[model samples]
Target chain A: MTWETVIGLETHVELATRTKIFCSCTTEFGSPPNTHCCPVCTGMPGALPVLNRRVLEFAVKAGLALNCSITRHSGFDRKNYFYPDLPKAYQISQLYLPIARNGRVDVRTQAGDKTIRIHELHMEEDAGKLAHDPATGLTRVDCNRCGVPLIEIVTQPDFRTAEEVTAYLEALKETLQYLGVSDCKMQEGSLRCDVNLSVRPAGSGELGTRTEMKNLGSFRAVARAIKYEAARQIQLIEGGGRVVQETRRWDEDRNASLPMRVKENAQDYRYFPEPDIPPIRLSEEYLDALRAAQPELAQAKRARYQREYGLPEYDCRMITSHRALARFFEALVELGVPPKQGANWIMGEVLGALSQRAMEPGDMKLTPPTLARLIALVGEGRLNRNTAVKVFEAVFDRDGDVDAYVRAHGLEQVNDDALVREACAEVLAVNPRSAADYRSGKEKAFGFLVGQVMRELKGRANPQRVNAILKELLMQ
Target chain B: MNITPELVERIADLSRLELGQEEVLETAAQLEQIAACMDILNRLDTRGIQPMSHVFPVENVLREDTVLPSQDRAELLACAPASDGETFLVPRAVE
Candidate 1:
C-alpha cells in the first residue's frame, strides 16, 4: 500500500515598511520594550487608526506581481481571539474580502516545474511577542510588533514532497523580495510559514486528517517538519491509530515535532467585519497602473536568460534564483563580457565565495565592475586562470585593476611557445629514462614532461600550450 | 432554542471562564439565539467573492533608515507597578 503526502502553506511576510500599518510608530525591530507603541497601536480608548497609504500600494504591487486578481472592493474583518500578544483582543484581518485571489507561482523541483495555486493574499496587522520566563513562570508581552503590517499568502494543497515545498517557498520568497514588498528575512521573524500536512493512500479520493505545523522559521525547518509529520501520520494510519488534527511546533534542537494544541477551524474565530475602517475599492485604472509596475518575475527572467544569454538550463536557474544576482549577471554582460563567461564566474566564483561565508550573493561586497574586470581579464588571457583566483580574492579588500594587480605580482601567463618549448626540452633531456620510456611507447612520460614545464614556468604557462609543446618535444 | 447542559459546560471550558450553574443556563440560551441570527451568512452564495483581509486600500508604507530618538529609561519605568531602577520587578514567578 503506497501513501502520498499532501501539503499546503500559509506564509506570513512582514512588509519592509518603515512604520506600523495603522499607526505612525516605527516598525523597526529590537526596540526598547513597548517603546514603538503609540495610542493607536496600543488600542487606547478613543484613539483611531489611520490607514497607511504605502501599505495599500505595496499590497497592490504584490498582488500584481503574483498574478492575482485585485478585488475592486475589499475590506477588513475582525478575527476574535484571546491571546495575550494581541492587546486589541480581536485582530483586524481580512476575511470577508481579501486583497487578491487565484494567483499562481511556478516552482522548479527535481520532479520538474510545478505551478502552485495561490488561494489568496491579504494584508493585516501583526501581533506582539511573548517572552516567557522559564525560571519564574511568568510571561511578559512586548507590544512593539503589534500593528506591524503583514501579508498572509495562502497556497492550495498541491505539494507532494519536501523538495517541492522548499522550491515553492524559495520561489515565493524571491518573488516577494523582487517585488520589493517584504524583506523575507527568516532569521528575523520577518517571514514565517505554517505547514498543513496530510497523507492518504495512493489513489484515495478522500483527504486524510492533516496536522498543522506552526512557526517554521527556516526553509529547512519547514521541509524537515513536513517530512517528519508526514511519516508520523503514515505510520499512525498503518498502526491502526487515528491521526488527530492538531497544531504542532517544530523543535529544531530535537529535530521532532510535539503537539501544541487542537487546531481551530474558521468557525471558532467568530469573524466579523471590522467597524473601525472603511472598505477599499480599487479602480480599474489603479489596477492597470499596478499591473504595469510589476517587473519581470523569476520564471520570465529564467526563460529570458536561457534564450537571450544562451545559458544552460542549470546556469539560468542558478543565476536567476535571486533577482540581484540576475541583475548582476546582466550588468556584467552590459560591461561587454561574454554571456557564458559571465555566467561561469558568477555561478562559480561569486557563489563559491558566498557559500564559504554562509552569505547570499547579494551580500557580496564585490561590485559588478570588479567582477566584470576579473572575467574580462581571464577571457582576454591578460591574467591566467590561477592568478585570476588570487585577484578575485583581493576583491574583498576593495582592490580593482585586475591587469595591474597581476602585473605587479608577476603572475602573467608564460604563453610564449618558444619559452614552453625550451622548458619542455630541458625536462626531456634531464629525465632521459622518462624520455627513453616515451621513445619505448610509455605514454605516461608525456604528463611527466608537461608537469616539469609548468613547474619551471611557476604555474603561469598555459595548459594548452604546455600540452602542445610537451607533445612536440616528446615526438621528436 | 433549547440549550443543552452539556453544551453549556463545553462553552464555559472553551471560554476559560468559571460559570455558575444559573449563569451557565442563561448564557447558553443567549448564545443559541445569537447563533440562530448569525446562521444566515452560511446561505449566501460566496463562490467567486474573495475574502476581505484589510479595509483600506493602502500599500508600500515605509520608514526612513535614519536612527531616531528614544524615550528615557527612567520615564518609561515610571509606568511599571514594580521596578528596580534598571529593570521591571515582578513577583517570584518560577520554580
Candidate 2:
C-alpha cells in the first residue's frame, strides 16, 4: 500500500548580532572556550538578562519578510530543563507570545508550487558547546557560544514529501540571506533544522504518530532522514507494529534513525513567564520604519532588474541570487557602466575569477568602481578585452591600482593611426601570397593578413583597426 | 492544599535535586506553604482588572547590538567547579 508522509521543520537561525543576546560578549565564532562569556551568559547568580535591540529588529524584519503578522507585545518565557550545556537550569525563550505568527512562504519544487505555513517564530538564546572526551568520556562545556541569539521558526505540517521540505529550506535560506537576518550557513552551525515526520496510508484523513528527528546537519541529511523515518514508520505499521512517538536522532554514519528518548512533553519544561526581562511592546511607527527600511528581496530585485534594466531573465536570476552580488551589480550601474555589459563581465569574468580563486562574491576585493573602470578602458579601446581580463585577474585579489597595472604591463592596445597603418603596410608587403589571395576574393586570406598585422604590432594593436587599415592598404 | 510525597519527589526529580526522607518531608511542608500562599493570591478576582504578568510597568528594555570584550577566560573559567585551565570538565555525559 502507498503511504504519504507529513513533515514539519523547526529551523533555528542564529542572528548576525555583534553581541550576545543578554550580555556584551562578542558573538564571533571559533573563539577559545569560556573567552566570550560573562556573568549573564554563564548564568552566574543574581545576574540579570537584558534583551538585545538588534535581535528584536531582526526578528521583526524576518517576520515581515516571511509574510507573518508581527506580535506587537511579546515576552520571554523560561523552558526549564536539566541539560549539561544549559548553564542556567532553564532556557529563556518565548512561548505564550512569540515575536511573529501565522506566516507563509511559497516554495517551488518539481512537484509544483506549494505554500508552507509558518506556525510561529520565537526568539531565544543558544546553548553552550559540549564535547565528550574520547579517552575519558568526560563531557567538556564551553560557554563561548552561550547566549547567542536565535529565532526558532516553527512551521505547520504542510509538507508531503522530502522534496518539498528541501525546497522550502532552500527558499527560506535565500530569503534569510537576502534579509541579512542570518548567514544561514549549515556547515557553520548557524542554521540548524530538526524534522518532525509521520507517515500514514495514502488517502487517510487521520494523522499518524510522528517522531522528532534531530542532528540534521545538512539538507541532504534532512531529506535522507525524512525518507528513512517515513519508510520506517510505514514498514512498522504494515507489519502489524506501531509507530512510537519519540525523539529520534539521525545518525549520518549509520544512515538510520535511532530512538533518543521518550518524547519530552511541553509540560515537562514547566514554562513560565520570565520575570527578569519585560514584555517588548512595539509601536506601529517602529514597525513602519522597519518595513520601510527592508531591502529589495530576491523576487523583487529579479523583477526590478528585468523591468528597469531590461536584463535577461537568466542574468537577473543569477545576479540577484545573492544579495552581495546584486549590491555590486547595482554599484557598477551607478558608476555609469551599462547594465548588460556589467552583467556580462560579472557572469563571465567576475564569476570565472571567483571560481578559479575559490572566493565568494563578497570575499572578492575587486571593487565595483575598479571593475567599472576596467569596462570603461575596454569601451574606450585603450585596453582590449583580452588584456583587461588579465588586469582583472591581477587586481581581483589585492584590489591593486588597475591603471597602474595596465601601464606597468604595457597592455594598452595600439590605438595610434600611424602605427597601425605602418604595421598593416609591412604585413601586406611581406605576405604578398595572402595579399594576392585576398585580392582574388578569398575571405580567409584577409583574416590571415590581419593576423600578420597584429603580430607585427606585437599583438597590441586593435584587431578592428588593423583589419580596417589592412583592407584600405590592400585595396591599393 | 495537600502536597503528597509523590509530588515532592517528582518536583525534586525534575530539578535534579536529591532529597533524603526527612529532607523530603521538610521540603514538602515548605512547598505546600508556598503553594498555599499563592492560592490565596489567586483567589482574589476583581472584575474588569487585567492580570498582571510583570511587576515592572516598563516594556522593551533592550540593549543595542555592539560587541564588547568578554569576561577574561581565566576568570570566567575559574567559576567552574572543575576546569583544566580551558573548559569545565563535567562528568561523562549521556548524549
Candidate 3:
C-alpha cells in the first residue's frame, strides 16, 4: 500500500524584547549562568509577575505579518507540569484563547505555492536550558533563558514532503526577521521547531498515529527526522505492526530517531487560567497602529524587487530571503550602483562568502558604500574584475577602506597606451615563431600572444585594449 | 460526570503524586462530590452572564522594561534541596 506523509510544525520564536515576559530581567543570551534570573523568573514565592507590554506588541506585530487574526480577548493559562528546567512546576501558556489564530503562511513547494494554515499563535514563557554531561552523568540547568518571551506558532498538517516543511519554515523565518520580531537564529535557539508527523494510505482520509519530534536544532535535522520517521511508520504498517504514539528525539549522529517514552494515555496538562496576570485586552486602535507600523514583508519585497529592479524571480527570491541581504542590496542601489550589479554581487560574492565561512548574512560587516566604490573601481578600469573580487573579500573580512587596500596592493589596471604597447612589442620580439604563426593565419597563436602580454603586464593590462594593440602590431 | 478510580490514578500520575490505592478511591469520591457541585452550578441560568477570568476589573497590568537586581545567589541556592553553588542540582533529566 502506498503511504503519504503528513506533517505540521510548532515553532517557538523568542521575542526581541529588552526584558523578560513578566519580569524586568534582561533577556540576553549566553550570560553567566543564572545571572539574568530574578525571584519572579526563578519562581520564588511572593514574587508577582507583571506583563511586559513590548511582548504583547511584538506578538501582535508577528500576527499581523503572518496573516493571523489577533484576538481581542486573550488570557494566559498555567500549563501544569514538573520538570527541572521549569522551576515553577507550571508554565504560563495559552490554551483556550491565544493571542492570534487562523493565520496562514504561503510556501512554495514542488507542486506549487500552497498555503499552510496556522492553528494558533500564543505567548508563553521559556523554560531554562538543561545541559547534560555524559561523563559525569549530570545535568546542569541554566536559568538565564527562563521567563523569556516566546510566541509559539502552531500550523495545521499541510506538509506532504520535507521540502514543503523547509519552505514553510524559511518563509516563516523570513517574515519574522522582516518584522524585526525575532532573530530567528536556529543555532542560538532563538527559534526552535517541533514537528508532528504521521503517515496514512495514499487515498485514505484517515490520519495515522502521529509522533512528535521535539526540539530539532537545525533545518537539516528537521528534514532528516521527517524522512526517517515517515519511513519507519510506513514500514511498521506494512509489517502488520502498529505505530505507537509517543515523543521521539532525533539523534543527529546516528541519523535515526529513538523513542523517548511511550504513553499509555495522553498526559493532561491541567491547564487553568493564570490567576497572577490579568487578561490581555487589545483595543482596535492598538491593533491598527501595529498594522500601520508593520514593514513590508518578504513576499511584498520580492514582488517589488522584481517589478522595480527588474531582477529575475530567482535572484529576487534569493536576495530577499534574508532581511540583511535585502537591506545590503538596497543600500548599494541607493548609493547609485546599478541594480543588476548589486544583485549579482550580493547573490554571487556576498552569499558565497557567508556559506564559505558557515555564517549568516547578519555576520557580514561590509558596508554598501564600500562595495559601491569597489564596483565603481572595476567599471572605471582602475581595477580588473579579479582584483576587485580580492578587494571585496578583504573589505568583507576587515571592513577596511576599499580604496586604501587597492592603492596599497598596486592593483590598478595598466591602462597606459604606451606601457601596454611596450609590453606587447617586447612579447612579439621574444616569440618570433608565434609572430610568424599569426602572420601565417594561425588565429590561435594570436590569443597566445595576448596571454604573453597580459602575463608580462602582471594581469593589470586592460584586456580589451591589450587585444586591440596586439592586433594592430601583429597586422603591421 | 462520574469520577472513576482510574481517572483519579491518571490525574495523580500527571501531578507526579504517588497515590496509594485507598487514597485513590477516597480521592475519587471527593472528586465526585466536587463534580456534582460543579454540575449544580452549571445548571443555573447564566446565559447572559459574561465569563470573567479574574474577579478584578483591571486589564493590561504591566511594568516598564527595567531590570532590578535579584537577591543573593548563595541565599537562593540555600533554599534548594540540592545545589552546586551556582545551580539547583537535581536528578539528571532524561528526555
Candidate 4:
C-alpha cells in the first residue's frame, strides 16, 4: 500500500527593512557579531522598542499579496522562551491574534494546480545567530539579528509530496519578493523555511506523527529533506516500529537528516499577549493604499505573460519564476526585442548561467540594456543564435559594451544567403556520395550538409537559412 | 488553564530550561493563572476579525549598497567575555 506524505511549512522571511523592527539598529547581516545590537534589542533595562513604521507597511503588503485579510486590529504577544540566542527572554511575537489568515497559494504540481492554505502570517522579532566555534567548544550568540522583523508564514498540512512542497515554496518566495516584503534570498538568510512532514498509510484519516525539519536554507534542501524524511517514516512504520515525533536537522553533507531534539507542543510556549505593546488598529484607508502598492504576484504575472506575451506555458513559467528575470524580460521587450524571443533567451542562456554559478538573477551584473542589445543582435541577424550565446558569455565576463564585443570577436552572422549557398555548393561538390544519397531519398544527408555549412561559416550561418540552402543545392 | 506540575516540567523542557523543582512548581502556577486570563480572548467573537501583524505601514524602504568603515578589533573585542587578537576564544570544541 502506498503511504501519503503530509507536509506543512513555517517560512521565516526577514524583512528587507533598513532597520530593526522595534529599534533603529541596522538590519544588516554579515557584520561583526553584536555590532548592530542596541539597548532595545539587547533587552537592557528600561529600553522600550519603538516599532518601525516600515515593518508594518511591509507586513501589510505581504498580507495583501498573500491574499490574506489584513487585520484591522492586531497586537504582539510575548512568547516566553529562554534560549541563548534570544537577548530578550520572551520573544515579542503574535499568537492569540496574528496579522493575516486564511490565505491560499496556488502551486503547480504534477497533479495539476493545487491550492495550499496559509494558516496565518504573524510578525515577530528574530533571535540571534548562534555561531558555534569548532576550535573552541562554545556557541557564541550574535545578537545582531535580534529584534529584526520577521514574518512567519505558517501553512496548513495541505501538501502531499516533496515536489508540491517545493512548488509551494517557490510560489511563496516569488510572492514575497514581488511584494518587496523580503529579499527572499535563502542564501543570505533573508528567507528560510522549516518543513513539517509526516507519513501515513494510504486512505488513512488520522494524521501521523510528524518530524519538523528546521532552518532549511534552500528550496532544494526542503524538497530533499521532506522526501528523505517521508521515506524514513514510512519505512519505520512498515517495519512495525512507531514513528517518533521529533525535530530533525538536514545535514546537506550527509544527504540525510539527524535527530536534533523532540518536537515541542504549542502549550509549551506559554504564549501571552504582550503588555508593553498595545493593539495596532489598521485604518481602511491605510490597507487600501497598501493594496494599491502590492504589485502583480508571481502567479498573476505568469498568467499575464502567457496571455499578453503569447509565450508557451513553459517559457512563461521559466521567465516569471524570478521577479528580476521577469522584469528584465519586459525591459528587453520595451527595448524592441520580440517578447517570445526575449523570454526564450532569458530562460535559456541567462538562467543557464545563473544556475551554473549557483546564483540568482538579482546577482547578475549584466544590465537589462546590455541583455537587450544581445537579444537585438540575434533578432537583426547580425549575430547568429549560437554566436549570440558567445556574446552573452563575453558580456557576463567584462560587463562590456555588446557592440564592441561583437566587433572585437568578428562575430557577425553569415546572413548573406548567396555566400551560404556558395558554402552549401562546395559541400555538394566535395561530398558527391552524400549528394547522391540525398537524391536517393537519404534524409540524413540533409543534416550532414547543414553541419558542413555551419562548420564552414564558423557557426555564423543562420541555421534555418543554411537548411533551406542545403535543401535547394541538394535538389539541383 | 490550570498549570499542573506535569505542565511545568513540559514547558521547562520546551524552553530548554534547567529550573529548580521549587521554581518549576511556582512558575507553573503563574503560567496557569496567566493562561486562564488570556482565555478571555476566546469568548469575544473574533470569527472574522483580521489579526494585525504590525502597527505601522511603510514600503520600499531599502538601504544603499554601500559598505561603511567599521571599528578596530580592540573595540569589538571589548564586548566579548574572552577573546584573542582576531577571534573570540572559548572552551575547546569537539568535532
Docking class of 1: incorrect
Question: Per-prediction TM-score, please?
Answer: 0.83, 0.90, 0.93, 0.78
The best candidate by TM-score is 3
C-alpha lDDT of residue B39 in model 3? 100
Tens-place lDDT digits, model 1, residues A83-159: 76776767889987899999988887778988999999999999987665665555665667899999999999998
Overall lDDT per candidate, in order of appearance: 0.80, 0.89, 0.89, 0.80
Give the runs in model 1 whose Cα sits over 4 Å from its true position: A1-4, A30-35, A262-267, A397-399, A415-433, A473-476, B1-95
Tens digit of lDDT per residue, candidate 2, span A1-476? Answer: 98999899999999999998999899999977888898999999999999999999999999999999999888999999887787897899999999999999998888889999999999999999889877677889998888999999999999999999999998888899998999998989999999998888889998899999999999999999988998899889999999978889899999999988653443499889999998889999999999999988988998999999999999998898778899999999999999999999999988888889877787888899999999999999998787788888888888877889888888899999899998888877888899999899899999888877777776778888887778889888
- Residue-level lDDT of model 3, residues A109-129, one tens digit each, is 778989999999999999998
Tell me the number of clashing residue pairs for each predicted model. 28, 0, 0, 8
Maximum-DockQ candidate = 2
List per-model TM-scores for chain B: 0.54, 0.78, 0.88, 0.66
Ranking by DockQ: 2, 3, 1, 4
Over A448-475, each residue of candidate 4 has an lDDT whose tens digit, in order, gives: 8788888998888889899888887776
Which number leads on lDDT?
A: 2
Off by over 4 Å in 2: A261-267, A416-459, A465-476, B1-4, B21-51
